[model samples]
Target chain A: MIKSVAIQGVKGSFHHIVSQQFFDENVNLIECLTFDRVVEALITKECDAAIMALENSIAGSIIPNYALIDNYNLHVVGEHYLDIQHNLMALPGQTIIDIKEVYSHPMALLQCKEFFKNHPHIKLVEDKDTAEVADRIHKNKLKGVGAIASVLAANIFNLDVLAHSIQTIKHNETRFAIVKRTNSEVAKEAINKASVKFEANHKRGSLAAILNVMSDCKLSLTKIQSLPIIDTPWKYAFFVDVTFETYADFDKAKSLIKIMAEGFKVLGEYKNAKL
Target chain B: MIKSVAIQGVKGSFHHIVSQQFFDENVNLIECLTFDRVVEALITKECDAAIMALENSIAGSIIPNYALIDNYNLHVVGEHYLDIQHNLMALPGQTIIDIKEVYSHPMALLQCKEFFKNHPHIKLVEDKDTAEVADRIHKNKLKGVGAIASVLAANIFNLDVLAHSIQTIKHNETRFAIVKRTNSEVAKEAINKASVKFEANHKRGSLAAILNVMSDCKLSLTKIQSLPIIDTPWKYAFFVDVTFETYADFDKAKSLIKIMAEGFKVLGEYKNAKL
Candidate 1:
């Protein structure tokens, strides 16, 4: 049973929300500033598990986090999809007119760029984290500062929301993975999705052959990303996420892929959280 | 005859370097702070063409830039690969001991993270661009500030290089694409590569079938990236780069893919720079 979880930001972050939704509300929170630190805490047994964002619908894959998880040999035990809504917030008495400068994560600021054009007086500064900025504004009582973060951050940090859903795209979602140091303990019958990494041979239709095996085994490819192997200049390792109706289908496909592809490794076997 | 080229940063950025190496050194440079503005400058005829970094050897693809190019209907005429070297630069006569803060682009700061770990006293701040930070430090005569940028930036800003190749990875490379409002004017026989976007059908073997088509046509797949179609939640538009021995093979593959796939569009056709 997991009692403590590590996340890549302070309280009121998207990772914090994932921890609450995936685990019990009373679970202990271990805050980490960077994804590297999150993995470190898990590996060092400072936390039972770690939640990391894998991809965003708008921005695509967080490739570095994928590298961190693959390099650290972390397991994706579960997954959660969070709807990202950026809100501009400040101290209770402050309004958009009163705010002089806004500080938040660079990605958040980019997403909310259209909203800021109307308020040309507000200067945007990039910070490390979104919720951290909101927390700072509340604790420091910074008068003319605002933060772009989730609504939960405003509630948690006691800041008033000056604007809601200020992101340019209203349908932004991020996929987060619950990772552990060990392989998932999910029962076979309950497992419907799997993440795997493999390198195809340098020949024509090599990747297609592997995909054919998955299709023949009745597995649906949900996501596929290719990352260049660091030591090898031109070689690539393909990271794939597939869902199936039965665990036996995935099991058979995995057996065939291990034989067909080089450097075959199972990153995770988990329930399909998207469904 | 590309005269003026727009880039995402000042004259010393990787994109700027690409512009000089790919085009004539006498070409005019129109620097923009954002990729959106880079496209804007090209679309509005402020520059004859623009240079954009497509991917890095260390980091994966710059996904958002792909969106920008596709959305704006920009054409990629050529590509170049630059060996990236991040240097620590400060005002002349200043040593590393005197530097209290280091400013650079977030990506540059992240890449050179291992080097900064040894110097715990130096605070790392995220800025808009690496060359811009170097220019600021020099113009302001900031004594205790350092910027992690290219050696060319240090030279252009009249700053001293405190350290060379400070990035953790020594073999860093970035691929930049020269984009313009019109397609490549290179003769058909000279074109060896093409980038296309297509959406596979919602079936088990649809993607494999498309890859089979490319294989049968003798087109070797160089790169493949999938970005979600924002309106359609789970569906993805695959951005693929393929190199072939002859233009006839790519032409054959293009005709077949147009019939087999949905929303098939050619993004670029040019010589493969990696070769």
Candidate 2:
């Protein structure tokens, strides 16, 4: 059983919420300042597991996370999707109209670009984290400054929610993965999913060829993303996630992909989601 | 003859170098703070044309550029590749050993993660811009702080170069495109290269079918990238650049591709350096 988890944010951060969702309620939590530190803590055995957001429906994939996941060789044990609820937060006694400047992460600012455009009088400032931005706004007592953050941030910092679901898109969910130091036995509560990385020949139809192979093998591909192959200029390797009916025939599909691809690796075969 | 060009960044930025290479040195230059501003300047008649970085040799595509180009009907007029030189800089009298913290844009920091790992004593801070970080270090007169920026930044900010070419890869280069608000007649300097973006049907082998059409037409594909169609989750649209032997059959090939693809647009036919 997991006893503790280390995440990279304050108590009201989205990461913290995702971490709690992945681990037991009784588990102790350690908060780090950066995502890299969260990975470091898990690799150094300071934490049992770490929950990292891999992609958002509004912003697409978190590209850096893909590179980190590949470099760290961490095993993704499970996954969860959080419906992101962005709110306009301000110190008590302040209203939305009073906001002269808004601060949040670049992604948050981007997700709420429409709001900023509608309120052209407000300046958008990018910060490290949304929750951290709320804390800073509250602690500094900055007048006429607002933060686009989660409602949890308002609750934790004792601020007022000026607006709710300010994102232009309603389907604002972020996909998170629970990563462990090593592969563990599939927990009964976990769903079955497989993560894969593969490189294709520089030929024109390489990607299409691989997708055909997946279709032929009857693998239901859930996601596919391409990252530049840093070692080779103008070449790319793809990362994919697939769901199978069962763990059965996993090796067969893996072998078939390997035979068809120039290079391929199973990042991890694990239970998907219990949430 | 082109009189002036607008680009993103300060005078010594890589984009500046690319613009100079694409246009004559005598051309008047307009500087913009952001990529969108560069495009807006062209669209609003503040500048005749804009030169923007589209992809980095080491960093892959600058994904947002694709959307910007698609959203605005800009025509690619030319392309150039510039070799990037990343440097570690610090205030005068501060050496690498004396630095306890390093600041840079997130991409630069990620590119130099290995160097940070080797020197675990230093803390990595993410800033908005590399040049901006260098400027901050100079203005603040801070000690024990360094920045990862371009050598041009070190020179501009009067900072000393603590380390040179610190990126993990040596052949780091960025590809930039010259775009105009309105299409121009094909010039003598125009080469046999073209870029296109298309969306295929969400069915098995749809992308393969498009690639097959390109191959059958004997078009040599230079690069292909897929960006998520945000409106339609789980679906992707592909952007491809191809080179042909002559302009004689270019239109025919493009028309065939359009017929095969569910959605397609010819970005431009331009002369570009052959990789």
Candidate 3:
């Protein structure tokens, strides 16, 4: 039923790429420049759902996005792990020597900075979006400037890739969350992963006791992030991800965690993406 | 001999404010526009130390800074907590009604978004630095534009305060870490807080058991963040912060954690900033 999905970039950004591969290829894209807007589109009923980058292999968790999900009362219905491949591209017939400056997102530049070190002549310029830079290069016929982006971006902008997979780390991957207003309609049997939020008591060994509860339920803890409760100084709300092979085991853990921890809320129940 | 310190912005950044308060006010600053350069300045001995924002009460951990500290082998020698106060400033005699747009760093703008919502006529624009925007408005004598920055910025840029503490959260605070090339020079008895990094074996309840060990030793866990090991997919390097009333208790817990965990490394042992 997802006819249109909100993405935080243009046609060929990583969010767009994930949307294309995970959902129907022909699904409409509601392009937004910021993650806030992507959430806005979902709340305003402009899109059926949204795809958000949750974390990166090298950079770690996108903590604010987790905050937004909790604040907006959105549900993470599923997830996808995308192997990030950044390529240097420019207008057709341009060589690496001809490039005077390279434009890309700050993170992309950080990932591929070692490659640029070899070519000292090329200046690195931080840009907002990689695909937007490539599109501008092709649209304005700008010469001597290159952009580090995905291969899909090169194709969408009709540019030529000067280098393939130029990122410094070859195994870089990013996790994306598919979010919607309501919980996913998938069958209960398909659910193996669940993300929950809770607060540990002020007493000593509170978090340890909660972790022991998860362990006793035979739940595998995948991710855990602590978010500050702004109203209460020095207190935190823990966001956790756990996977299990059986629904009964997960249900038992959920019930026990709710009793052991304060402010417990199950954010999502979805099938394991890697599986 | 902390004579020189590196900061990520010009005169009135949050980093600069914390630096001035933590170190000597006259400490020469090696200003770097990016954290990467800040790390570089430390590695090259361009500065004696650096003040980096580790986490904000509302925004949670600055994950990449954690990665940079781990990867570059920098040691956190000290810590400070700053109460963030966002002030709206403009040219002299400009009233709130006279302003048409407010500019600040994206996080600052987001923090103060609720304050601007009542006045829809005034647009909110995202800029690189809060103090830099205030300086620009004062330098160019630009009217009808306001910038959300610190009181120090208003004094430095000669701007009038239109409003004080415009951030939505009244009790917002950010924690900064004073870092250097080698470990801190403080006396061992003065240290109560410590940050350690470790990876658990591929066994069930491994992390839970580690947390239990710390609890048994009377150490209070303040924060824990997971960083992905690039070579091993799904494996994480946990960065943990703990505080203890007695050094003997901490040593007991540290020794046990080293035996129970893999790739264990103590990043720093310093006095608790909040205390």
Q: In terms of lDDT, which candidate is strongest?
A: 1
What tens-digit string does per-residue lDDT give for candidate 2 at A1-275?
88778776877788878876677778878788777888898999988988888876544667667677778998887788888878999989997789999988887887788877888889997777888888888798988999888888899888999889998776777888888888856853353678889887556566666776766565665666665576575566888877665565455677888988866877777775522
Candidate order by DockQ, highest to lowest?
1, 3, 2
Ranking by lDDT: 1, 3, 2
Query: What overall lDDT goes with each candidate model?
Result: 0.89, 0.77, 0.88
How far is B152's C-alpha from truth in model 2 (Å)? 4.5
Whole-model lDDT, model 2: 0.77
**Model 3 residue A36 lDDT score:** 94
Cα RMSD over interface residues, candidate 1: 1.6
Model 1 segments more than 4 A misplaced? none
Can you tell me which runs of candidate 3 are displaced by over 4 Å?
A: A97-103, A114-127, A136-145, B88-148, B157-159, B166-171
Best by DockQ: 1
- Model 1, first chain, TM-score of 0.97
Candidate 3 lDDT by residue in tens digits, B1-275: 88899998878888889888998888998878889989999999999999888988776788889888888989999999999999999999999999999988877987898999888889988677888998899889999999999999999999999899998889878888999999989998999999999996434578899999999998887887776677775677888888888889999998998888888888889999874
Q: For residue B269, what is the lDDT in candidate 2?
A: 84
The chain A TM-scores for the candidates, taken one by one, are: 0.97, 0.86, 0.96
Model 1: per-residue lDDT, tens digit, B37-123? 999999999999999999887778888888888989889888899999999999999999999999998989999999999999999
